[model samples]
Target chain A: MTFLDFAWPSFLAPGRLWLLAVPPLLLAAYIFLARRKSKQGMRYTNTGVLQAVVPPQSQWLRHVTVGLALVSLVALALAWARPFGTDKVPRERATIVIVLDVSYSMEAVDVAPSRLAAAKQAAVDFVNQLPASYNVALVSMSGSSSGRVPPVTDHNIIVRAIEALETQPSTDVGQALEQAMAELDQAPAGEDGDPPPGLVVMLSDAAGTTNPDKSPRQAAKEMGDRGVPIYALVFGTDNGYVDIDDVRYPVPPDFSFFSDLAALTGGQAYAADDASRLADACQKVGSEIGYVEVDKEVTATAAGLGLAFAFVAAVGAVMMGARWR
Target chain B: MAQPAFASPAAAVSSVVTEPSGATIPLSRLAPEAALRRLELTIVRRLEGFLQGDHLGLLPGPGSDSSDARVYNPGQDDVRRMDWAVTARTTIPHVRDTVADRELEVWALLDATPSMNWGTGGVTKRDLGIAAIATVGFLSQQMGDRFGGLIMRPAGLRRLPARSGRTALYGLLRSMLAEPIVPDGTKGPMDLPQGVAQMARSQRRRGLRVVVSDFLTPGDAELDPAHAPAWERSLRRLAVRNQVICVETVDRHEIDFPDVGEILIRDPESDFERYVNTSDEAARLRMNAASAAQRERIRIAIRRSGCGHIQLRTDRDWVQDIARFVLAYRRVAGRLHAPPRGVSR
Candidate 1:
């Protein structure tokens, strides 16, 4: 389901295009007469009485069966159409870092069970779903953020670093992001003189940091300006119930600044509201902007769905027979 | 207290209406004697022009034309009879309108009896009657001949006078339904022949007359030519004059007695009643045979009556059966109406 192979080196299989006709034929049959009563069939006097004695006839169900049959037929046709693709989908040949915010303020149960927990869960999910071809670096932020794993193609290591993150008072998201970018800048570019698209996924509540000189938003904006699209996820309650710093600020800093910073570039910003949405957010960042390769490989050989179509046709015949009986 | 079962409380009081079975059958036209609703009028409209024939009263009376005299067609009848047109259109003999078919005026007849009320099928005998009468009436109207009707019920007959055209057809039909049910059986046994006789005399011209009924009436032993059977002489005499159409209406149970347990039966005639256990297969078979025999009598009566016959049952397809009959009749009439083909010169 990963559309990597088709991105650039898309090989067209002509045979698959021909399979499109079977469904339209079936649709025509569905729309037209199923039975020929006569050239000008006499209109029955009592349609109701005739209906009762006649077998069960479902117009819509037949239409649906015809539709499925056509779909399966097309599938088979495409199979014959000989769909072809590149051997391996192009992968981003570059090192990338993900800085995850794990702070006490992250515990502001604003977004969910707690901002820190949501951030950690998202970072871990993000690491797990990403293509393994790219080297990833992991950095954790608190009152002061630190790099746990430098950018490398070692998914297990990156995953371990993300998992090890825990809530703490150190809330410097800026430091964590800067450290990640520094790690990525040292990596060599691919043969084309262009580094595979570098993606920096930043997970945070954007609710901490006393270092006003370079705020988390400013740090993200600066990093994004230098070619990296900073994918920022802001986890918090818009109602301003989040905790900040060692002292309760009563009002969380409008974390909208971090999202705006990321978006200023052609980057993305996601809101962590649920586990599924958070996972999808990370996956989207990795695929669309990151252009990164995953560890597991996917190869699709479009199988002739003719048999599937035949199965549908059989079901339809059975239904028609039962009604006739 | 239960609205005396027989609508004719007068009859109920007059005689000990020995109900054959305890089942309380309403021995009356159960329909509310209200003004014809706008809907039923439409049912006729839909069925208009189905059956065509000019057999007024549908009985071969003393006045019915039984002569078939026609000239042979020339050049495949394409060039046959041309009187003044022979000298005008072209110097060729072309025959047209030479086929002689005695224009028959079909009188719409309906049987609206209490027994007609029971229906195991989609429609009651009354409903079939409605359709049958409308089919014939519309056909007659379409042919541009005189038409009228007789609507029969257990109560009595309502007579609508013979007239020509669509307005008369509609009026006769509406009036048939409009005739108030005098509730007390005051009008006497549904006069099956009143409408036919009325149309016969009123028109004063011999035409096709269609008599629609279930023919459930018991045969009068004397006048009936056979051992008294169902609808014998009454139908025969009606069919004696004019081109007669015998439309016999029957119901499912009348033909086949389905084992529906002990059903209380009531004879629509005589107000005579008794009990018969339907649970016994033997008894059911016996009753079924008798019904079949009665149907046979009905069939024979219609045949001997010298009339075009059609039978519609409550449990069977009345409309299709009707269409099929009409188509056959039309086929015959079409052959007769076809210009006579020429003999090779």
Candidate 2:
């Protein structure tokens, strides 16, 4: 989901919103009393003589204490509402497997330099953005898919593996998914007898050789059942072309296959033709893989802030030597 | 107990008449008797010699109309007062002198109103009045004069009989110190005018009549043009019979308020309350102007009644103020008593 679409859960104590009216009412009463006090002068033996020596200060400054108190009261009312917000909490551990297409068709220069080069850069950017505690593995898929780097927490090793990739004769999408799942399965189980949350980021043009022994949909179903989501990034535009042996071959990008695979695995699919969209896809994927959402009650924090305001108001009153009416 | 050595009046006066330094010691800090004793010492040590032989005679005495002329001795006779006619006839120097017929009677009309109890300074206006009275009383004693007073208390008028000596004077001071201070908002039976009128009616002696008060009596011409002050007529009466010195006691707070933003002021005697916005510049200015005008009017009233005026403030060193006043009065007296210009006898 987009960042703007993020929503907080409903307040546990919505009825407390009605208490917000107390501060303004108190402020109004204070103002009325202050005005009345200003009108009712102090008792002095000689006002004429006293007026000649003493000058009055600004009226607003005298109300600083009451103003602060009012703010604190408003803060207290907000605290009473028992607000619960959606917080992005870090998972204890996580595993991310980056699958790169090393197929010959990935050499298309529809994007800057070539699609393969752009995909490698996006993979490196994505790994760099992930949390240090996340184990990142790399897989290169062409005629056959292989785990270039076993699942590890060192992002530098994963980045180096992506850079070392070379173009192969054919694409084997089903093999890449199988290799990524194998890398995820190798991660150590947590104390609760469950593996850490896993994510697969596949960067390719979605044009692969068909193999009856391995189906992409079957692989996606297996990963989904195991509670792993695969983020599929389809590179190159629909009008993409590749040059092979001095002859330019039309190899337009196809996203339907990757889109269906991501949908089955409870993940998203993105199509990128340029560096900007590639970076955006990598950033969204990185954030989604690294963090988990949880409901957090902020009542205590709001109460603490309210107390702090109250303390400030009390201190202001004491310092100003303001008398109670 | 060994008796304390008594210094000559002139020597004692010289020692204490120097400009007073520091603040006025509050009565609360000392016992009533001790405070009065300290006041007595201060007054005697500062004013004795300056006022010696300055008492104006009220009756005839041993005369010098050539009737009491005697042969003058060179060392004993006052050379300035040598009788020229007697010297010319007897072929020898002769002098004439006159002795005072009676001791000077000094009376004080003290206003011990509720207003006097208020002071923002080191001491209350009432304390200042007592100090003034002590100063005048001790000075009168040093000059071998009788002292008496009329106190205007919140309860009623208190008449102190004229008596001589330090004991009688201390007794009067002790009584004044013992006088009950009326709290704020208490309605007093008598105002300053009635007190002065009472003094005028009872005390018919020709003496130095001193009136010590804050002089804030309302219904005066200063506050309202149509009405004359209640004390004006009585003060005139006292002024005619006695050498009236209106010692107007003032406090700084009476002239100007401290910068306390808003205050409610209540008149102690009248129980009248007024809320004032001290923060208002215009209001402050107006209050100050009104006070100044009232002071000027009081001065005019004192002048019209043919009485000498001296204002003593609670904030000031009262002894120094009194010394300055006495010195100025002496200068004026010297000027008035000086022989006609170029007419040396």
Best by DockQ: 2
Best by lDDT, which number?
2
Compute the lDDT of residue A109 as modeled in candidate 2: 84
Model 1 Cα lDDT, one tens digit per residue, A1-325: 5776445322255534655776687678756654432222211111121122222223565566767667767666666655544344455465667877776666666556666666677777777776677778887777667778877787888777776777666466667767777777765677888766677777776645566445666777777687787777765655545445445654363457666867765577777555566667777776765443343211234453467666877798677445231
RMSD (Cα, Å) for all candidates, in order, is: 24.4, 16.4
lDDT string for model 1 (B1-345, tens) is 122123222321211122112111231232222211211210110011223333322222222333232343555543323354544556544433422323444566666544444444544455556656665665444344667666665555556666777666666656554544222112354455554454455544444667777765532212233664444445454443345667887766556665544333333343322223345666556555556666676676666655567897654555456666766775454322222233110
CA error at residue A194 for candidate 2, angstroms: 68
User: Which digits, one per residue and each the tens of the lDDT, describe model 2 over residues B192-238?
Assistant: 88888888888765566789988776322244433456678888877
**RMSD over all Cα atoms, model 1:** 24.4
Best by TM-score: 2
DockQ for every model comes to: 0.00, 0.10
